[model samples]
Structures are given as C-alpha cells and as structure tokens.
Target chain A: AQSVTQPDIHITVSEGASLELRCNYSYGATPYLFWYVQSPGQGLQLLLKYFSGDTLVQGIKGFEAEFKRSQSSFNLRKPSVHWSDAAEYFCAVVASGTASKLTFGTGTRLQVTL
Target chain B: DTAVSQTPKYLVTQMGNDKSIKCEQNLGHDTMYWYKQDSKKFLKIMFSYNNKELIINETVPNRFSPKSPDKAHLNLHINSLELGDSAVYFCASSPFDRNTEAFFGQGTRLTVV
Candidate 1:
C-alpha cells in the first residue's frame, strides 16, 4: 500500500525565516508525489508535484521540495516565509497503477509569526 | 471561474437525517473523487469516479453513496448521518490517465448533530 507520512504536527516560524516540512512515503516502486496547501476553512491548492524528474522541484509561492529516493523523503522548503504563508500543508502520493487514488499525510499546520 | 465547486459550503443537520453534497468541475477532467478530511486534518479517499464509472471505492460504509452524473460532476449522498460523519468533504478532479495533480474544490463542511 502507498502511504505518506508528515512528521511535524505543527510548526512556528518568524517572518522571513526559512521553513522545512518533512514528508516520507512508502511504496513499492517509484511513485508520484505532490504538495498541497490549505488555508483555514478552505480547500486544498496544489503547490508542486514530482514525477520522474530532477530531484529538486519548484512550486508556486516561492516553495520547493526535494525528493530523496534513498531516504524515501520529499521535504518542502522555503528560504523566506511570509506571514500570509501560514497554512496547513499536506504531502500525498498517488497509488500505483490506473486507480489514481491519492494517499495523503496527516498534514502539518504552519504558523508564521510577524 | 472556479475549476471545481461544491454546493452548501456549510451544512448542519441532525443525526439520522440524510443529506447530499453536490460537486462539479469545469476543468474537463475525466476523473472525479471524493475525499473526507477529519477533524485532525487527515484526508482519506472516499470514492473515485472516472467518466461516470465507479473506479475506486474505499472502505466507506454502505450508508454513503457516490453518484457521478457525468465526467464533470460527482455527488456524495449519505444516509443515516451520524455525528462521526461530521467533517470537511473535498471534491477533486484530475486527468484520467496521467493522474499527477488534482484540483480541489473549496470543500463542504458537514456537521451532524
């Protein structure tokens, strides 16, 4: 079974500080990965995705994630986080085959302090 | 225009009452899905429809039924709603074959009293 794990439950960071959110996945073969952000009471918005490509993938809103096959990790990073960047982040992996189901992580809530 | 939209952004009803959440996507995607986000923000796939065909049905209860009138719409109907059913339900759509990124709706918050 394909699964995604986001270790951090919540994180607090000052404005303009660097941010890193950890994500790990378990799958038999190489899997498709994605990062999504959701604001309070809102739906999810796709930040970035990783298929078979360069390990470093850039996403919207000055966000990026690096996929490490050895560690089974896809960690999201940002050099400078703005206060408006505070939101919930989810890491997901698409199940193998044509089923096209997405297995999502528990999500990490980010709190940006001004 | 919204890529995906769900009706009744907020719903509050009593237990045993049946309710339906309607979803539509204008993105011309062939696949639509229903996901449930619990209080703890854990999202789980509930059902998936491709071109109006049921493709992925999770371990959801029989009381929950998903209907896809077409490739652009998928609706979720729940019978005998329980307090446990209270959560945010998200509707999403993606291309049928590639299945990389999925566009999600604003979500419908269901509250069962």
Candidate 2:
C-alpha cells in the first residue's frame, strides 16, 4: 500500500516569504505524486503533479515541487507566498499500476501572515 | 460550465434518514471517484468507477452504496446516516491514463444531526 506522510500539521509563513511543505511517501516502486490545495469551504485543486522525466514540476499560482528519489520526498515550495495562499495542502500518491487509487496524507494547514 | 458537478452543495438531515448525492462529470473521463473529507482535513477514497464498472471500493460501511449508471455519472446513496457520516464528499474525474490528474468538484457538505 502507498501512503503519504506530511509531518507538519500547521505552518505559518509571512507574506512574501519563501515556504516549503514537506511530504514523504512509502511506496515500493516509483509512484505518481501530486500536490493539491483546498481553500476553506472549497474543493481540492491540483497544484502540480510528477509522473516521469523531470524531477522538478511547476504548478499553478507559482508553486513548484521537486521529486527526490533517494529520500522518497516530493516537497512543495514557493519563493514568495501571498496572503491568499493560506489553505490546506495535501500530498497524494498513486502506486504503480493503480491509476485510479490515490492515497492522501493528512493535510497541512498553511497560514500566511502579513 | 462545470467539468465536475455534485448536486445539493449543502445537505442537512437527521440521523436514520436516507439521502443521496448525485455527481456528473462532463470531462468525458473514463474514471470517476468518490472521496470523503473529514473535519480534521483527512481525505479518503470511498469508491471509484471506470466506464460504469466498479474498480475500487474502500473499507467503507455497507450503508454507503455507489451506483454508476454510465461513464459520466456516479451517484452515492447513504442509508441510515449516522453522525459519523457527516463530512464533505467530493466527486472527481480523470482520464484512464496514469499520468493524468483528477479534476474535483466543489464538494457536497453533509451534516447529520
């Protein structure tokens, strides 16, 4: 079974400050990774995804994530976050051969302080 | 136009009542899924259907039934709802390929009192 672990339950970053959300996954082989954001009372939106080829994947709203095979991590990063970036971010993984099943981590609540 | 849409954005009902939530996707994706998001912001997959065929069924209660009449529609029906069943349900669809990303609906919030 593939599982995602987000160590930080809550993260607070000031506006214009850089941010990084850690995500670790447990999977036997190379897996498909994704980052999703959910604003309050809204559904989850795809931030980015990593399947093959490039180790660094860029997403909407100037967000990006790098897939590290050695560490089994796909951490989301943004150079400068805005106040509207505050939301719940989830890290998800789909094991090889399981295209429809997505295992998500307990979301990390981002708080952008001005 | 909404690529994925779920009816009754907000549903409030008492315990022991039966209710249903309908979902439709116009993306023409072959796979559709039902995901539950708890109050604590944890998401879990409940059911998935591909081309009107059931593919993934999680460890959900038997009271929760999902029906896919066609490739573009997947409806979830809950029987004898409990307080524990109160949560936000999201409908999502994606292409059959592994590299594709799933598009999610706004979600339907269900409250059982």
> Each predicted model: what fraction of the native A–B Cα contacts (within 8 Å) does it retain?
0.69, 0.75
**Residue A30 of model 1, lDDT score:** 88
Chain A TM-scores of all predicted models = 0.98, 0.97
- At residue A61, what lDDT does model 2 achieve? 99
In angstroms, how far off is B75's CA in candidate 1?
A: 0.7
Q: Runs in model 2 with CA error above 4 Å?
A: none
- The residue-by-residue lDDT of candidate 2 on B1-113, one tens digit each, is 99999998999999999999999999999999999998898999999999998888888999999999999999999999999999999999999878788899999999999
Q: Could you tell me every candidate's TM-score relative to the true structure?
A: 0.98, 0.98
lDDT by residue for model 2 over A16-110, one digit each (tens)?
99999999999998789999999999988999999998999999999999999999999999999999999999999985664557889998999
Off by over 4 Å in 1: none
